[model samples]
Target: MNLTSAAMIGRINPEALGASTLGLALYNTCLMFGIGLTAAISPLVARERGSGAVATTDAIRRLVHAGFWNNIIVVIPVWCLLWEAAPVLRLLGQESRLADEAASYLHVMQWSLLPALIYLVLRSLLAALERPRWAVVTGVGAVVLNFVLNWLLIDGHAGLPALGLLGSGLATFLSNLFMAGALSVAVAVDPRFRKLRLFQGLGRVPWRACATLWRLGAPIGIGIVLEVGMFTAATALVGHYDPVSLPAHAIALQVASFTFMVPLGIAQAATVRVAGAAKRAASARAGWVALMLGLGVALASAVVLVTVPEPIIGLFIDPSEPGAQAVTRAAALLLGIAGIFQLADAAQVVLGGMLRGLQDTRMPMLIAMFSYWGVGLPLAFVLVINNATTGVWIGLTAGLFTVALLLLGRWWVFSSGGRRPPIA
Candidate 1:
């Protein structure tokens, strides 16, 4: 999508930027919003206080059942909204021929949105069920499918007429459909999912338990939004920069997402571990569970990027492609800051998850607001936008570093001596 946007933005007028940006941001948001909300299961499982010994399988079954239905809330709106893409894009301020083309892409892409949501729900279910290997396999398959279909459809291969951006959207939608079906089938046939029939319908979840999830998951959702928005905002702010720079950031941004996938997994593990420990009533262990995971991944992400920077980054940007230099510069920027950011980046994300495990989100949200908005936003405005790539990266780093310290410290205070009882 980033690459697509980069390619399109060059010829479009300035009016095309807002709808294009919002469409990409919010449409992709359907999945992130679900994944963030679905994270409730791990912490909820940790908090189970039932006196009678429930089988672990039963606990997991209930968790998956609860998670699947909850995700529907976000998924339903995503595809539905696509029906109005033309009007919506108009509302977002797209004018001229780009508006019509953007609308076509948006509408076509909507069909794929719900399937991605399904993938997120399934992935979260696996995490709640304690099965990362399955999750990983399913993810790899989705990536491969998306890539192949993208090539075949977008360029009109195999005697099919080329569909352009709209075709790309169709390819994306089909790939997601393929992935969602596969993941759902895997769950349906799995001994674990079958035992619970969690997919049968919503399982029995206590009212308090439902409330507990919203309590934990809501701010985590908002925090996820703010954090993602912060960077996406960087992308947006850059939209106001040179037209070519926007696409440059787009290519760089996509590459960064893949690199950040490592920390993304580590953060998931931390959220799960903390929840598991909380279930066991081990606060100290919960903290360490998260800390250890972050540290373990920190070296791996930084070390590899630090060691062989160019080859890794260069793969994303082909020099022969027009405007590829922008991609190269963006990739280099990500590479240069790899070490400076990931440790704190890892620490911050893990700690945020740790807080989610403890059902403590308000504090983290406040810290995020301060770090990203109060400090990060203004700093970025001064350095990056004003100077155009001069100090924007520095401010972005400053914001991330602030987030790491504040959230980890927040975790420390509670884990050390706070009155909060360990979840049963």
Candidate 2:
């Protein structure tokens, strides 16, 4: 959906593309917090189901319940933050026109946060239960729906108003709503899940369970925020350049993020598989297999990015446009840098999930903070200050590589007969 929106908006104008990119970057920085919190649900549920206790279903139910409450608690402040995105962006040194345009996109898009988080909770539950088929189905459906809506609404097809950037935001909001609803229906009706009554006790607060969630989830949230915040900061720095730079950065980052979903899925599967393993050997095996698969996917994605940069860039913006040559050229260079970092990106994310299955989040969180803020952002600043746009991505590559190596070392320690990290 993001790719589609970028493509359509890019065709309209570079300014629109930059505005949408900045708005979405801010939105995603906030979204990662919710995602990290909900992520605790998968390992918790998976471990519980593997425990062989008769109350496993009840335990999973409590965790799911707590996750929904967590989402509610997290969304309120995030919504408030997004409401003032324009002011915030302006404070970050964004141009006034770009800030206002981005804020307009956020105004309509912020409502998607709650539903998107809810969908994550449900999807995590389904994945942990080994019943992710429906969630995948619902996700694919939502993407298709988002594309159709983007077509009809973004350009005012079917006699509708040409809402442009706002239309893209509305399409995303509606698609997320559909995803939450469709997944809810899938869980409610499936015979495999109905007995669990995952949605039955929304009004009741499970204080203890909620506490457990925060205890385990907060570091994950902070870690994700650190990592995503680095990217967001980079986006802001890029925004300080010509309009072409921001859209080019957006296009390159979007392509990287698109390829990342593959490894991310493998990582999620690794979390469930490792958490469910009855023996240390089984857990180690699961982690290794996931890493290999993630690396393989990363290699293929990197090859595509390196070899076919122009075609891919063309997908997002027209090179034939008078002002698009600079954007396309810049995006191609960034994509090449993105390709070089794909392996590091895959390794770190997959390793993070592997450690997460052991419920080892705090150390990873600290590592992310140091690698991104300490290493990546500072380097990016130095490079960008020298007027090197591609150097900005090189800094990102360095950061991802640092995190990957550090995370790999941590995973090795855990898999080599070291003491298990406390769940907290």
- With a 3 Å backbone cut-off (N, CA, C), the pairs that clash in candidate 1 are none
lDDT tens digits, residue span 1-424, model 1? 3443333332232233333444565465555666667776665654453223464665566556556556665667766776666665455433435446556677877777667766776787677557766767776776676666666665677988876566656766787787778888887798856675656545454455455556667777777777776775665456545434544444445545555666667666666666556243475576667677776777677777667766754544445666566555655665566556777777788777777766677778778888988887789888875666435556667888899999877777777766663331
Tell me the TM-score of each prediction against the true structure: 0.82, 0.98
RMSD per model, one decimal: 4.5, 1.1
Q: Which run of 10 residues does model 1 get worst, by summed lDDT?
A: 6-15
lDDT, candidate 2, at 180: 96
The list of candidate 1 runs beyond 4 A from truth reads 1-23, 49-52, 55-63, 77-103, 202-212, 278-282, 303-309, 421-424
For model 2 the local lDDT of residue 263 reads: 97
Instruction: Give the top-scoring candidate (lDDT).
Output: 2
Estimate every model's Cα lDDT from 0 to 1: 0.63, 0.89
Q: Which candidate is the best by TM-score?
A: 2
lDDT score, residue 149, model 1?
A: 68
lDDT of 2 by residue, 1-424 (tens): 6777788788777788899989998999999998998999998888876777554667878888899999899999989999999999999989999999999999999999999999999999888888889989999999999989988888899999999889999999999999999999989998988998888877898989999889888899899889889889888988885555888898998899999999999999999998989899899999999999999999999999998999999888866676788888888889988998999999999999998998889999999999999999899998887766777888898899999999999888778888776664
